[model samples]
Target: MADKSTEGFYEVFEVFSKRNEKTDMQYQFSLLAPNHEMALAMAQENFMRREPVIDIWVIKRSDIRKMTEEEKETLKRIDNKDYRLTKGYGYLKKKWREYEQGVLDENEILSWGEDKDATDRKRTTS
Candidate 1:
């Protein structure tokens, strides 16, 4: 039989905070409390006191359902971000020859006009 003095198990709560309304809530820390009110208060006092936060949230750890490894893999497969890399953009060797210019390089393509002088000026020998 259970002891008369024994209390129920304490619930774990995960805290999330948003610096501003435009930003998404980020995981901050976890706290164990007997109820939601206490959890929110504890989270606010323990974590948010030092940091600047526009909003705060507290959710029960048991309520959260995590994605499986297979689901993670599926997301990886679906996200085809090769175009963001060098190889995905393909080599412009022939095109550069046709235009009588050097092939687009990493710095050149990524510069976004910041290196306008380098790109526009002809090579000089000193």
Candidate 2:
């Protein structure tokens, strides 16, 4: 009887959703349901009722290829891909400093949107 119950419960399904068509689907959680249709209906109301969801997927737990304990232990390497980030090119800062040139950083770029001259005229005339 215990084995029978375990077999029945093995039909657990995981729910996932994508915020938009371009975004990747993220796992919400797992729930037990008898069939795929029932799982999908329950997932929409339970997990995505409060947020934007353009796509949904219901996958059986058994279908997922999960990593073992040994794989997880070996996967904990440092993510030192400095070549992929601005931090890797930090030497450019010193090079620019030698030229006495200020870097056009994010703040300076955003400041270009401010119409300071217009605002000054409005303040003086008003």
Candidate 3:
């Protein structure tokens, strides 16, 4: 076999996929291919041979822009933006209780997206 390192035949490619149209894309696995097309083709056979994949992506590892240690440190700078989080509005729960009304927390707000009957049943059961 030819020397892959010198010829660049062993280029690393990261794979990502989604199970269905509504699902979020997730990391699959990495593969070595000479080019993007081959990497995409190989990904289906190697990773999705026996599974259902709604979408697939093959990105050359070298093409991804990654932050260096120094750049990453800049992201650690903190800002006083507590008002953007639910904790900042925690006093609303007590205020609502004073009015004899319930306050919807994060979980309650998120559960609104589920079936109404199911959510009601879950609330009753718990």
Q: Could you give candidate 2's per-residue lDDT for residues 52-89 as a string of tens digits?
A: 78888999888899899999988885777779887789
**Tens digit per residue, CA lDDT, model 1, 1-62:** 54555446577899999987789999988988889999999988876559788888999998
State, as a TM-score between 0 and 1, how close model 2 is to the true structure. Answer: 0.48
Question: How many times do residue backbones clash in model 1?
Answer: 0
Q: Which candidate wins on lDDT?
A: 3
lDDT of 2 at 31: 91
TM-score of each: 0.53, 0.48, 0.63
Off by over 4 Å in 2: 1-6, 19-24, 45-52, 68-81, 96-126
Residues 1-126, model 3: lDDT tens digits: 777566765789999998998999999888889798899999988766678988898999999998999999998848888899889999987887877555557777777766687888899999
The TM-score of predicted model 1 comes to: 0.53
| Sort by lDDT, top down from the best | 3, 2, 1
lDDT of all the models against the reference?
A: 0.81, 0.82, 0.85
Model 1, poorest ten-residue lDDT window? Answer: 117-126
Model 2: which ten-residue window has the lowest total lDDT? 1-10
